[model samples]
Target: MNTNNVLRQITYEIYKQRTVMPEKMRTNYRIERANGGLLCDLWFLTVGCIHDAQGGCVMCNYGKGSGVVHWDKILGELKKIVERLPWEFEDFLLTPSGSMLDEREVSKSMREDLCGILKGIRTKRFIIESRADTISEEGLDFVKKAVPDAEKYIEIGVESSNNWILKHCINKNTTYEMFQDAVQKIHQAGMYVTANIGLGYPFMSEKAAIINTVRSIKDVLNDGADSVVLFPYHIKKGTLLNVLSENGMYRCVSFWSLAEVLGYFSETELSKIQISWYKDYFGEEKSYICSSPGTCPNCERKVLKELDEYRETQNPEIIRRLREYPCSCHAEWKQQMDRENGQIDIKRTEEEYRKLAEIYKTDRQLLEQEIGIMKDEFMRRYGNE
Candidate 1:
């Protein structure tokens, strides 16, 4: 078998052996109004991800729960969340650890209870997050049957259409072909496909990250995705990204980058997707990397306010206004992007060296020198670093 295949088997073994903490198997819920008249009641299931055994995505911390708990108990907890939800919500978003439809992460019994909750709530529409490999037509069909009266939409994490980034950078263990197939099947079932595109992968420059994200969005939309959600790269504790950040290999994208990327999309295109990121999703104690409150103390308020306004209105003029908002660090951000472009694959190379340095304590200086040489050579080849 190939290396990834072998790794997958090993990880599955690890998952099987790992213990689950019942208390951690919790849920997080929130309510928000979407553009037009859609009221969204969103929630996250803490029952850990199946892929966690294989090392979860670099930026994801949602799979923190152990899925080893009792299905009935998990269902009982979800019922409490259902009770907390407002009496009426037009759209219900259930994004659990990994794919909500994945029976491994969310047991069949748990899924049944989820379906019953949807029916009981009588929502006009509902959305679920899923990975490409686990999204089967039959599973979605089951959801449709359960929510016969409501419109069903599936949100897949098509982080990047580029296979290299998906595998090497994000460790998603999914392919573009798989995503395309999933989207095709979702559309075949007469359901809307919403893809969440990841931005700011470590190995590439900001410009490259934006280009890849925009391309993925267009490709998926062209393929069958009705909408796309932009997830700016963020770091979390205990993830590979956190390690990289400590080594000065990764930096979180500023809000300016978010604005620049969204500005690239047309007003009509912007309206189709979800982009209200300023409202903290993780609550008080949970920490997020690169998502600082605002660009600066003085500029943050206006930037966040404008972002919310643009998300609701999708007015090109609002984006234009944001693009013009002057910040002291704008020039520095541009220069950083340019230098990062020139540096090219530094993050990947640095990651390998980091692992080696951690193993051979005495050789840390040698590793640093080697990285310096690599950077110098890169600069020589591409004008500047």
Candidate 2:
């Protein structure tokens, strides 16, 4: 028998045993490439989760979200990787799921110890994915000590900025107050903030999206977010969204609209504000989709490479359309800044104003059917003065 095959079988058997247990917390994970670099493949052997007493996110699968046994064993596997991999590469990071369930004090101590190990190994960087609510002052302080001087980014799934939508429909159990506090703490820790935001959910509106998107970039969100992940609403299996779809209580955002959202991030206008934060971090382009935020700096570098390639392949027409796209957040921002700076020559052209109106109309027709059935309710849920 092949030695590799035997090892594979043994690993699979162990994964299966852990997975099939009634109280099973561990899950099998695929060793996939993070982005465009080496040493970025997450070898997820010995990975797992600790579930909530209330089950978990209504949108989560017990398999994809779960099936990993524990973060400690996962950490051990990474340590083994450091022992085995080529010496030239940068370090691997540690990230955990169901992060809410981890022992707070122990987690901090473990990360401190991890920092000592990686520093000894001369690793380059480390990052993590966590909940907005879990990012307490104490936790931020701990992470700061451990990851001191590394280029760190924290990805928080903020979902939506609208308190009503996040509270009533999504049931995330987080408050706007908590989100604000987390942002302040993250900033205090001297790290980059990445927001995981979504749009076009059940009661989401184009205008609300515009306002929230702007708030995220301009107000509190701008203060922290280095990159904004514009996650569109996709129907998943065994989730509240899927149930809503089945009962016709919701409609998914169109793929075209989703493209528009991406365009929002790609705009040169956002570049101004994003740059306001990073005075020295200047470049012509917008954000890069870091393949694995918490794991691979190598992949992140490659992601920047690919983003440049993507920008090169696009035509001026697409770019212009993006410039004119409604919520011309970038241009509006420039205009607003110019006004404050006493440079008043900048005004959106009549055509530009009309185009923004057209964008709203087009995006609104997206919810035509459901809105027709529930016009007053839609207005109450989504409209702004």
Candidate 3:
């Protein structure tokens, strides 16, 4: 079906509508509990994700604010941020808007320069994020050398274990085998690996989303991941998810669904799971996020509080409490999950594809053909059920 070509065509059409702008980016940091101690989480801006230029993830808008790369300006700002930090931290996380290991995003010389600026920080564990394909032995070795004093951890966004969902749904362009290979490389380098699992993709039923996420979590854990991070769906501007939501074909994932997914694991597994982007953290700018996971106005605040507590404590009892917590929307969410029609609706999906074809001026016949193929494949896979 040439899914990449289709996704790229739509992505380029959306990109044409976007205006490039330069704004004063800020570095955000926060202290949180992890591994029985305080962990410092820090995020900085860079040239942005390289994949965004070629039809990136459906739910991501990380590359929107970025334009061209100015290494001097970015490194100078990072140095200023590092200078302001305290002498020591228990665990330090340095996250960039894009994959730090991608040379196109952050060149080798620039990485060395940034590492020079960060080498002085005393930390027990140093964590960074990268895409699975970019996680080479050289990159892992460089990070180990750059931060010799601390234990190294690389986080890769393995959004789903299902290759079909990874390609047709999220447009991630990564496979489960690629993720396993990356994890093995990291482990061979004597480092830790964390997998980031995403929930709430378009055209996926609530029950299917939860089930897929749970399976993904288990897959990564069994593949030697040291921890997992759960990222609930956030509708961001300038992405395919936003387009779907605007057209009434999508809705934000409910917080209860996240709680339900967490409940499937024991306290030991739960301890290794951390929820992020459910709500804003580090006082970062959220103007780009149209909506995030939530239940209702009545219980939103309390649910968020419990989620935050769970993030900090990793206590299974909190999830149990949330399961028992009363809310008017809970029943509705349960009903959606318990419904028999738990697969993607091929008819609605084809309609949306047709609408996209008209709006983006693509080939209507080709989209129809692709959708027909997808429908047949779905039936062949699930008809017996």
**lDDT per residue (tens digit) for residues 121-199 in model 3:** 8899899999998998778877887778998989999999877677667778778899999988999889999999998
Candidate 1 local distance difference test against the native: 0.66
Q: Rank the candidates by TM-score, best first.
A: 3, 1, 2
lDDT of 3 at 80: 81
- Residue-wise C-alpha lDDT for candidate 2, range 1-385, written one tens digit per residue: 0011211222232233322323232322222122122223232322233322232332332233344246566566556655554443242344554452145413555556555645533335445656776776666665566545566666676666655445433545565556677777778778767676665434344334444554544443445566555554544443444544555444554323333444555444333221101011212232111111111333334333433333334322443453344444334433543443221111221232223224334344433332243344335664664
Poorest stretch of ten by lDDT in candidate 3: 19-28
C-alpha TM-scores of all predictions: 0.81, 0.54, 0.92
Judging by TM-score against the true structure, name the best candidate.
3
Checking candidate 3 for backbone clashes, the offending pairs are none
List the global CA lDDT of all models: 0.66, 0.42, 0.79
Task: Supply every candidate's count of residue pairs whose N, Cα or C atoms clash at under 3 angstroms.
Answer: 1, 12, 0
Overall local distance difference test of candidate 3: 0.79
| lDDT tens readout by residue for model 1, 6-109 | 22332344344434433653555666555545455445455567676565566665545553555566567778777666566667777776677787776676
Residue-level lDDT for 373 in candidate 2: 33
